[model samples]
Target chain A: MMTYDALSFLLKAVIRFGLYMLLCISIYMLSASLRKKSPVLIVPTFLSVLISGSMFVLYDARGQKSGLDHRAAVRWLCEKPILFTILLFAAAAVLLTYVTFREAHLRRTVPDRSSIKESIDHLPTGLCFYAENGRVMLVNHRMNQLCHIILGRDLQNAALVWDDLCGGSIQPDIMRLSTDSQPRFRLSDGTVWSFSRTQLPDMFQITAVDITQLHNLAQELEQKNIALEELYQRLKVYETDVEVLTRTRERLETKIGIHSELGQTLLATRSYLLDNNENKTIPVEAWKRSIALLRQNIVENAEQFTLQTLIQTATAFGISVEVTGQMPEQKDVEKLFLEAATEALTNAVRHADAKKLHISLTETADTYRICFQNDGKMPETQVTEGGGLGSLRRKAETAGGSMQIDCHPEYSLTISMPKGGTENI
Target chain B: MTRVLIVEDAPMDRQLLELYVKQSGQYELVPSVESAAFAEFCCRTTRVDLILMDVCTSLYANGIDAAEKIKQNFPQIKIIIITGQPECSFIERARKAGVDSFWYKTETAESILHVMERTMAGETVYPESTPPLQFGYITSDELTARELEVLREVVAGESDAAIAEKLYMSLRTVKGHIQSMRDKTGFRNRTELAVRARDCGLIIVDKETE
Candidate 1:
């Protein structure tokens, strides 16, 4: 009997512990699913259930071993149900604390709409939005101030703002906005405002900026440009005047040099006419009076100056000379031909006793020739080169040309020199 | 008597020619003209044996042109061109124009009447050379053609290398020419020679003399 009672007590304790374990497992699984929603409550809930179950098992085993009455065992088992209920209530309180904490965390992470509204209100530029229905959805403080300044009145809606700004001057429906956003609005207070709009799904944002300073700067630049153009025109006129003055001065200088040259010729001629041994009848005073008369009728123009001087000088010696063809543009080449002619004329009169002299100028592709032939006495014998003829030959050769002297039927000197485009020497 | 025509632009020069013609006693003064054009017309219209033509006149600058025209028509008239200008330059042109003689007004030692008498007796008279003109330390005629070539570039402010390339000469040759010119001219440097050459217009060769 004692063995049977012992066996029965052991079996009963095992059965009760197994049932408590089942209950613990069920609550654990149920709490695990709810733990994801309020994880902070999971540990406390699990500890309460484990403690209450372990206390019940310890009380029952002690009662049974001490051979306690069934009522005592029953009372010990009853304490387990009260402990379970108390554990359930503690789990409920833990879940409520977790819920409160989560709400506070969400409030910290995401900002409220009021903060965004406050930010837009203090923006530097004017900001406003219009709903798809064309109603004024939101506006900042700057936007209101822009409306008052540009429109000359407070406007409630974007349509009213457009009407006030354009003043029916531009058809808003037909005007291309984004591609041509340069149209600006001038306020009554002389301030300039440039507006732009961006379209969104529910509404469109409009922005405006004061551009009065920029407009003033552009106007100032344009005015300066006009002034600069006028100054440039004035400078061009002054440059032209300077060029004319320089040309006139050059002409005057050439004339003065020529006059001085003429004066010297007159003095020389007076000495020559007075030195005539055969003309003892002509007084020196008479020649001086004649030379004085020659200075008064000189040509003043520069174009005819040199030619005129030559013509007059040749007339004094009874040399009837004529020139044809365009004058050489290069002064040096022209001088070469003129010098050779003088030498030939000298030989004709001094040596050959020639009376008539004929000079002809002809030009080829590479050379210009001055042919000097006179109706003078041909040499009785072969003529040798003298100081004058030798010098003439050298001049022609040095200039890359040649000189030919003919002493046959006619006394002639033909000098051919290189034309223009000669190397600068 | 020899019929003389005086074409002089200057009043004094014409009177001087008139006085010379009257004093010669062998020639009679024709109507004196102040222009080559009037002289040409006179030679065409009237009998003129001798024409005393100043190279420059009021109507036409070059008496050589008038002389050529007159000689083409009347091959019998004698023309003498007288001027104080550098005879070196005008001699060839006067010779080609069929002038009988050329006389330097200031430099000629011979009497104008004697040259006129010789020209009438079928004589062609011209001076030996131009009056001597000095540039720097050398005479104008002393500058050789090659020296003048180097001097032009120096006056134009070109470097030796640039001158060599332009003239198709070596750098050493260009420098040699410059140095030679400086030595011959007694100039201290290239700049002095160049400036004097420019002032005197001595470097007359342009391109063909190269």
Candidate 2:
């Protein structure tokens, strides 16, 4: 009887534990359904709660009726074994279905480990995180592909890959973006990428961003700048042409005016000459004016003022210019020499009434010297700097040269200029 | 006989044209004037059959402008625009002005009387081209348009830097043009090049100074 009583207590304890497990599972399902707002879990939770509550109530009534005798409850369960076995089988089936549905729901909603890795692998840019020991922590597919191209292997050590990129020992297919300190490279397909690194708390992160479009735009802009420069040059040439045409028109107008004046004067002379009346005179003033105009036109139309022209003019004035030694090959020096000779010719003719003018040219290592001496009378008084001499002196000084006039012991003028020093003039 | 009116600023050219009209014997000479301003009035008062107009007339009257007005008013009166200056846009302006014939005083090989006769004979007479002038070792026609532009600035006494700035070219480019011109002309220096160019009347600058 004691053994029966012990067995009854054990069975009661086993039943209570099973009921407690059912109650806990039901409550958990209820709370989980409420949180997720899942109507599918509601039926399963209600069934579990009802079964556990009814069983608990039946056991308690049997225990109270028998006055703490566990043997009566044992005998009660033994008599309805078939009914208890059916109920137990039904509860086990319900629990199995609920557990299976819950597992499927979790699989559909939650991301798996492989899926998370797939997302990181498909990123556009190259990304890698590495530890201090050069161990690759997290590397994407793009980075591994870049490593294969650069290092000829999959990414094992990200720090080594970064070192290879920075060392600039890559293949000819890769070109450096610029001479700047930034690490940027251009691939063979015209794709430009800029690589950069950042230090995290315990790791290092390296990234390569695509910059092809910006590089192409910069190249296009450079080409346009060159074209604009060419267009600006063309416009400038047109402007200068217009300016020249305008000036030419003005000169033609002046010439036409002079020609018209001369024609009018000729006509006046003809009319005066053909006049049959004795009241008309010769019009001497008009004739003189016409002659003056003709002379002015002739002088204006004379050859340009060069050394040859100057010499011809001096000869026309009954003064012969005797040039000795070779003239300097430099244009500016030759021009200055001719100017001084002209001044000497004018001074000799106007002031001293000379006939022969001699010009001597000589060159030293660094200076060109020209001396103008005329066979004219000596100056009666000390010669001062007048308009012509003063102007010549100013010009000479401006050209980085010097001019001197010696009045005594025959009149001679010497001017010296340094070679290659008169370019601005 | 065609009655003609002469409009010329210069008395010599006007007298010459008057003599040509009188000597033609086929044309009758009307009154002559010194300016194109009197051309329309002369046409209005007289029975004018044709008009000989000069491009640059006295009183600042442009003959082309006057000719355009006359053509609009009396299109029947045949007009011939004559000019001595080759640098001016007289030919183009005269054509746009609807003048009957154009004659260059110095450049045209044909006589002005021939041009007038052609116009009276219902022929549109125009020269093939302007007369080519000798400039240094090359003719004016031989110079490229760009080279001519640079030459004009050089003749204007502009420095290389100034010319480069004005023409929107580099300093080296201006120097290059000058050097090319020198090589073509075989001139010794820039001063000689400028002086010879001016003397040849290829490029005329303002003031006409040395």
- The reply for model 2, stretches above 4 Å from the true place, is A1-116, A179-181, A260-425, B1-210
lDDT per residue for candidate 2 within B15-39, as digits (tens), equals: 5456556655678987676556556
TM-score of each: 0.31, 0.34
Q: In candidate 2, list every pair of residues with a backbone clash.
A: none
Candidate 1 positional error at A39, Å: 62
Lowest-sum lDDT 10-residue window in model 1 chain B = B201-210
lDDT of 1 by residue, A39-78 (tens): 4445544554554455445555555665443456444544
**Compared with the true structure, what per-residue lDDT tens digits does model 1 show for residues B11-116?**
5445556755675567898878665645654554457899988765552236777688778867988999876544234677788988999876653222678789
Candidate 2, DockQ to 2 decimals? 0.02
For each candidate, the alpha-carbon lDDT, in order, equals 0.64, 0.70
